[model samples]
Structure formats: structure tokens, C-alpha cells
Target: MNSLLKCRYCGWVGGKSDFEWDHMDPKIKTESFLLDFLQGKLELICSGCNRQKSDKTSQDYTFWRWLFPRQANFGPIRAHTFMDTLLQRIHREIR
Candidate 1:
């Protein structure tokens, strides 16, 4: 059996087909930056979460939901960890 993958944002577990690529930061549009981002900065999230996060950086999306209690769906701790790990990886890659 194939190993299941979890969506970093929503924690949904499923086969690879159930996930899609998302950029950790969506504002950098340079070709070289995109290539670098594709190497490791891409996030794997479920379609629903991806659609909800469209055009927004992970930080913005998380913060917006956090600022408004009614729109929050996932746990804050999990989202914080995800952001922390992602930022660490990005920093390491840049150094």
C-alpha cells in the first residue's frame, strides 16, 4: 500500500492524489525564485484549503483566520508549528 500524506495546513490524510502544491509565499514572482521555491518551499495541502488560501501568503491566511475567531477551522498550535517549520526550512535554504 502507498503511504498516506498529510496536508500541512488542515491535517487531512490521504493518498498523494488528494493533495496539491501550494507556495509558502505567493508574492515572489521571479522565475529564479520560483525555481528555488519549487525545490522545497512548496506546501502540500488539500484542495479545499488551497482554494481558501488562494493568493494569500501562509502567514496572512493563518493570521486572518486567527484574528477572526469565527473563521478559524484548524487548531492554532498545529498551524503555528507548521509555520515555524516552514520558516526554518526556508531560512536554512537561504543560508
Candidate 2:
């Protein structure tokens, strides 16, 4: 049986086929490409959200309609933690 998975960005829950892996930070330009290789840099989100996010980082509000409402489902604490982890990963890549 195919177990259901939830989108880390949106609250969409469905089978694995409905989702795709998204980079937590998509704007990183690295010579060795170490950023994508790091842990906590990937998230499983729905294909629709993935396409909407495009190459923009989560910090970018270009897709506010898709991002903000869905993020609210995470509540304040989980949302803060999510953003904190994303920022930490970006900082790690920078240093």
C-alpha cells in the first residue's frame, strides 16, 4: 500500500506520486555545489507548490498567495522552527 505523505510547505496530503522534492533554498550559487548536498536542505512538497516556488527561496514572497496561507497551518512555533532551520542551512552554506 502506498502510504500518504504530507507536503512540508502546504497542507496537501497524498501519495508519493503527488509530491516532489524541493530545495529549501534555491538561490544558492556554489562552485562545488555543496549547498544541495547538505542535510535539511530538501523538503517534500506537492508538485504544484514546487512549481510555484520555482527557483525562489522560501524567504521570497513572490508566491505569497501559495506560501503564506499554507504556512499558517504550521502555526507560530513550527513555522518559526521551519524558517530557523532553513536560515541555518543557508548560513552553513555561506560559511
Candidate 3:
């Protein structure tokens, strides 16, 4: 088990287990509503992010919506193009 894991969103360092596995990947390129199952994860995130997502809070919800724009199908969806777009955005930021 990893004693120290850094969050990709906020970069908070802690035990890997402390982070909750986040469903849905932000980096999917295709429309989630079109697919039946997700191609990404259940990544370990901090409680703060988890709570925000669970509650669908304004800030967190918007953040997630921007990161992963889905049609609210209530299930997994194939995510490839979404990831590509997300990666492009990230790359643009670094450049």
C-alpha cells in the first residue's frame, strides 16, 4: 500500500487509501451518453473532493461537468475522446 499519494486535482498528499476511488474519468473524448460502460476509473481522491462530488455541490459539480461532460445516463460509458480532449486541455495549460 502506498503511504503517500498525491491528488491530481488539488495535489493533497496523504495515504493512498485515504483517497476515495473516483468513478468517471475527466479525460474522455466521446459522449458518455452514447456508451454503456466507462473506460476509465475509480481513482483515489480526497474526502473533500468526494463529498463535493457526492453532494453535487456547485463548485465541485461545475468542475466535474467541465472535466467530464456527460448526458446523465446513470451508468458507465465508453470514454476515449473525452480523455483526449482533457489531455489536450492539460497540455495547453503546461505550454
Work out the TM-score per prediction. 0.60, 0.54, 0.39
For model 2 the local lDDT of residue 51 reads: 74
- The TM-score of predicted model 1 comes to 0.60
By summed lDDT, the worst window of 10 consecutive residues in model 3 runs over 70-79
Cα lDDT tens digits for candidate 1, 20-43: 778877786446756856677677
lDDT of 2 by residue, 1-95 (tens): 77998876667887776777677687654444455556567777777777777787876633575546754333112445668999999999999
| Runs in model 1 lying further than 4 Å from the true structure | 32-34, 37-39, 68-95
**What is the clash count of model 1?**
0
- State in Å the error of residue 49, model 3: 0.7
Best by TM-score: 1
Arrange candidates, best lDDT first.
1, 2, 3
Greater TM-score among 1 and 3 belongs to 1
Separately for all candidates shown, the number of backbone clashes (residues 3 or more apart, or on different chains) is 0, 0, 13
Report per-prediction Cα RMSD to one decimal. 17.0, 16.6, 16.7
